[model samples]
Target: MALTGPNGPVMTREEVDRTLTRLGAERDAVEASLLALQDHPGRRLLEGAELSGRTRERWSEAEPGLGLLWSMFDTYSEALAAARAVRSRRARPGQSELYEMTELLRGRGVTVSAGQLPQGGLHITGSTRMSEQVSLTELVERMNTWYGRIIEVASAADAVWTALPARIDLLSAELGRVRALARSVGVHPGEHPAGDALEEMAKELAALRGEVVADPLAFWVPRPGAGTGAPGGSGSAPGTVDTGRYDRAARTVDGLRVQLEDLLRLRDDADERLEGIGETLARADATLAEARRARGEVLAKIASTEVPAVPGPASAMRERLAQADQLRRHGQWHRLGPLLDTLEGAAQRELQRARESLTSVTAPLAIRAELRGRLDAYKAMAARLGVSEDPELIERYDQARRMLWSAPCDLRAAEYAVMRYQQTLRPTAGPGRNSV
Candidate 1:
């Protein structure tokens, strides 16, 4: 495949075969390059080593592989082209040329697709001042054009490929270390793939690795795991440990791997469904960010909100209940009735406020707004319907009821006032003189 000028004599089949044999040798050389790359251990490069000491040398060696592959590819392609040209020329030379190229490629386990080559651009650019004949000159031009991209891709791939074997060994060693530590700690050391298994694991580990690789900040989030401070201040309930849950979680990780493979195959194209490897990672990052922000906001709100809890002296409610029981046993109907009235009022208002809070937290902007509006309307109705002091009186009534029902009892006057006030308002006042 290495282009040299036709020097000594005209081309013959024997000479061409010799040249092709050399091409086959180069193919072999390139194929052998894989093991070399593996031997070099490019872990540092993968770890972000760009052109460091050993990398540059490995990179330089890796660079030559590109040209080698390119040459093999070109030669195979040319053999194909020659066949095509001979075929076009009444199946004379082209057919025979095609036969020769096909034999060589097939022998080397290579499948050359000259017909697959793009049209128009073809030529050899490598300076071999040793040639004057243009036997494959036009074909080389096309080869060079195609070779550019091939070389570039191979160069990059080789850099990683070259170091892969060593990296795998490195990972294997590390995993062994980890296993030893786990054994020392009396924990199970799980099996993991060799580092070189990335390509094999690529499909299966796509989603998981994508998250770890692309967005470390997001994936390593502090999850609300055992002992982790989470919402509702929920932490791990301290107790003697059960390993069952840990085992289940480990199994879940396996499920995650399955999910990753499914994603790689089924969602390779989609971005929105978050089915692809890259998108899954991006979505996780975004989801974690939002979740964290929400948690903080809720904590802040609870810390600062002015919502009151129940009504009065918390112990007072117990005392009042006891007093009511005594009054009832002694046939003190008057006191019992008044106490009951106070408890009802305080309980009603407290219930209403609590309900409001629940609604506001859940349906903040709308449900709470509607409830407030209803209360406002009721107040307006109270005043507009000739009960000028009814709104304030109703508020006091509610507070009294709340105090009596909660662990408190201090609204004696408010309860008595409600009773008297209740008698004054007719049933018709509410839609038709309804009682207060």
Candidate 2:
């Protein structure tokens, strides 16, 4: 039965008993939640951290809010205990006990002083009352609101701190390795672009790490659909840690490491590369020398032939190769890399030019030899046919032989004489053409 009373309808004994059981469970849940918040790692970090920026400002308010949660919890606990005590006085509460139980469970039975609340009353309630009276239900709602706000701040700051600083430290360590490799290859700051960039990146990561440690919230981006009132959200966590700058720095370090590694490889291969270039230049010089000698022979043996002038050896490229080797000895691998490439290309071209010159300068001698072979073959064919003593054939053969054997040979005149001799032999040597 329900009785109309000042507080509200008085619950029946059964109703009161059921209500007590439910409120007791709520009380335990509230207690557990409060204790968990108290022992939260994020809360502890917030307490000890030298926070700055928005984090410091939010924590300033959240710190007081945390205290308020405990105080209001105390008030809620007391009201629940009082209601339980009134019911426990009798297994079946009388009318008066029922009235009090109704008020504690459903009516505004908990009173909170203004001093216990935040500056402008509870921000959730939107009230500035000097003091407030609320029911147990209202008290729990208020605490949930406070917990959401305070945890949001703590968890967001913690997330940023957890994600970035440690990664930056790892990257910094990798940066050190890259720097050492650069030094080994003689790629120092102010001498190589990668080295200077590495130095700048080191400074940036240091500053970034410091900023993350001091004010992690600055790097936090709230997740979409997340609310300020809850620690958990619809899709994901309340927010995410921003890693844009950190990722960029990581990519830069990787690129620098690649460049430095290439330089190291170049340093290891410098000797082999220098040796190969030296051989190429030497071959070019030998070819040019042979061409010069052949020019003298061609001028002596072949009359009125123009031999192309052979170029000098690749002196400039040889000098550059020497410079590159000296740089390698001094551990200046960066400078040697490009110089070796240029020198190698020039050396190949020099060798090709010298080979072409040798071919050109000896062309006349080759033609004279070819003519002499043809003339001797035809004369041999004539003798085999028993025409060696033929008056006309002997005269033509002697003319061709004199031109072929004489130094400063007239190649044009000798070629004509050989052709005339071959024509003279063709009619008589029809059966012996295959032998010739």
Candidate 3:
């Protein structure tokens, strides 16, 4: 009946079933009593106090009223046979395997019920019924649903993959036009020529592709709307003309388009030139997909191997901290950015794994502000720590950033450094002011 996760053992089959059954009955009673409670006189006025006891418990705890009711339904649907058997009092002997099977689900923050012999259904937690008391497993599941989550990231990647050629074509044409204008005035364009611009575009396109290929399921936000610009507006973002080189490819293709239009005006050689750009785009798409797969493999390394090997987020920090020192000694600040981003994501995720796997109805709280506060605190702490042992201090910073995985991150060193920063505060700021 016990479900094992990184945090510990979570809800037993027995516990989930009982909780669901109790919640369902309680909800029904509360709904029926609401009308009577609203119309009754005094103690007759209190004859059916609908919002008391468990109902009030759900409300005060900020649990969703409707979602809890539906949770019962999902539980019953996903584990119908087990639910029916539990309700029917037909217990199945040697049912330990049932608990084992649900281990994957419960570890993932899913609340499952049944398996008292052949009964099975999983009750996935909906957002509303979930509160802070909810397990971290559920939070991870919610992460799965989040806008910046892996699947959404993949959708964005596909979009960029699809849109890149158009962007590149436009930029390529602009480059061509600029070069022609430069030459017409007896001036040469930049030594690299319009062709070099295409190469730059290709490089950026390749990098974006590599990141996507490495992990289609992590996080990726498209360029405002992919290649910048509003939904229907012309591309206008600065450096977007470069689209980080995306524009180069776009304009080169645009160059061909302009050529085609002018040639049609004069019956010149347009068809062959336009077909060349089409070929480049077709090849780019195929190459992009290959790169995207490579990215997936990298993410899998973090998710399956690196993350699981660390025991938990806390331990993972220890491992990352150890590596960060070596990396910093080599002056590898560039590596640190991705490492921090990845560690932040993976550790926070693993933390949820621990929380969900340990306790049901005990989810961690939101920490958006905590994370920002930690970043600020760490900045000041790093400043203080950086004063003497700059190198050692940086090691500590890398370690601290890796170590503190809370949403609203925690800053142990910053708290320790409070006395150091005490005298550095602006004269006009105060305890009651926003200057802190």
Candidate 4:
């Protein structure tokens, strides 16, 4: 039954008991939520971290809000305890006890100090210099607001710490292995371009990891479309850490690793190819020496033709080959590989030149031998025609033979004389023997 008293329909005992029971449950829930917030890992991390930038400024304001939260919770707890104590004194609360319970539940029984409701940009409306009184329900609403703000800050920071540092560590470990492999293959700073790049990446990664550890919030990536203002500003959403820099570093290191592998393969190819080129160069020198000796012999035995001098060995190419060997010994494969290619091409060209020279130097000797063979063939043809005893033919044959067989013979003059003898014999030998 509802009683109509001066204060508008006072609640009956049954309604009073129900209201108290509900309030008690609400109080228990609020207290549990507060305790959980206190023990939250994010909250602990925020408390211990060396924060900076907007996070530092905002935490300074939020810190006071945290104190107010506990203070308000304590007041709410005491008020609930008093109400419960009063109700438990009797199986049914007396009129005075009921009046006290109503006031505790709905009236302004919770008091907060000035600036403690919400300060430092929190926007809680109260006199800054005077204390304020609020109902238990209003106080709980205020506590919820404070709790939400503080939790946002803590959780955002903790999320960045959890995600970025470990990923950086794993990437750094992979880079270390790449550096070791690079060293094994003679890819080092100042010696190879890719090795130098890898060294730079290592330094960047080291600095990035250190910065992340010291101030994770600095690396936090706010949610897209979130507010551009400070952390506690309106419409701001929480976000995770940014791993873009680390990802780029990882890709760069991987690219360098591939380049180093190619260089290592080139090193092996160059070693084999350089050895072959050295053999080719040695053969070319020998051929050139042989050509020079043959030139000397042709000048003495075959006259009236100037043989071109055989070219000397290519000393410049030999010098380059020696430089390549030095580079290979010092593990400068990046330089050695290209140098070897150039030397191999030069060596092959030199060998070809030497062979052509040898052929050129022996040309005159070949001509003199051809003349002697022509003279002998005409003599044989004359004997077959039964003109071997002809005095004119014998005189011509002996003249050509003396010129062909003698040293320093003028091959041009001897060739002319042999052609005259052949002309003289061709008509006598008849048209059927034109070739002989």
Q: Which candidate has the top score in TM-score?
A: 2
C-alpha-based local distance difference test score of model 3: 0.38
* Candidate 3 per-residue C-alpha lDDT over 139-175 given as tens digits, one digit per residue, 9 for 90 to 100: 3223222211212222333344344545445544565
Q: Candidate 2 residues 1-436, lDDT tens each?
A: 4478766677888887788898788777777767767777678888998888888877876777778888888898899889888888987767788888888888886898654544333453445566888888778777766777677777787788778888999999999999999988898889889889989999999999988987878898988876655312221238778899999999999999998898889998999999999999999999999999999899888888777888887777867887998998999988889898888898899999999999999999889999989998888788778878888999999999999999979999999999999888777556736434
lDDT of 4 by residue, 1-436 (tens): 5444433456656766787788777777766766766776667877887766767766775666667777877887887787778778898777777777677666786777766566444454445567777877777777766876776666666777678778888888888988887887788888678778988998998998777755666777767765322212332236766778888888998887787777678777777877888999999999999999999999899877889989999988888888888888887877776787788788889999999999999999888888889899889989988777877788888889989889989888899889989887866666666455
Q: Which candidate, 1 or 4, has the higher lDDT?
A: 4
Give me the runs in candidate 4 sitting further than 4 Å from their true place.
Answer: 1-23, 94-99, 123-127, 187-192, 224-238, 267-270, 273-322, 337-436
List pairs with backbone clashes in candidate 2: 303-409
* TM-score: the better of candidates 2 and 3: 2
Highest lDDT scorer: 2
Q: Per lDDT, what order, best first?
A: 2, 4, 1, 3
TM-score of 2: 0.80
TM-score of each: 0.18, 0.80, 0.21, 0.61
Instruction: Give the residue spans of candidate 2 off by over 4 A.
Output: 1-18, 94-96, 114-127, 228-237, 301-304, 363-436
Taking every candidate in turn, the Cα RMSD to the unseen true structure, in Å, is 27.2, 4.6, 42.2, 9.1
| Candidate 1 vs 2: which has more lDDT | 2
Worst 10 residues of 2 by lDDT: 228-237
Worst 10 residues of 3 by lDDT: 114-123
Residue 336 in model 3: lDDT: 40
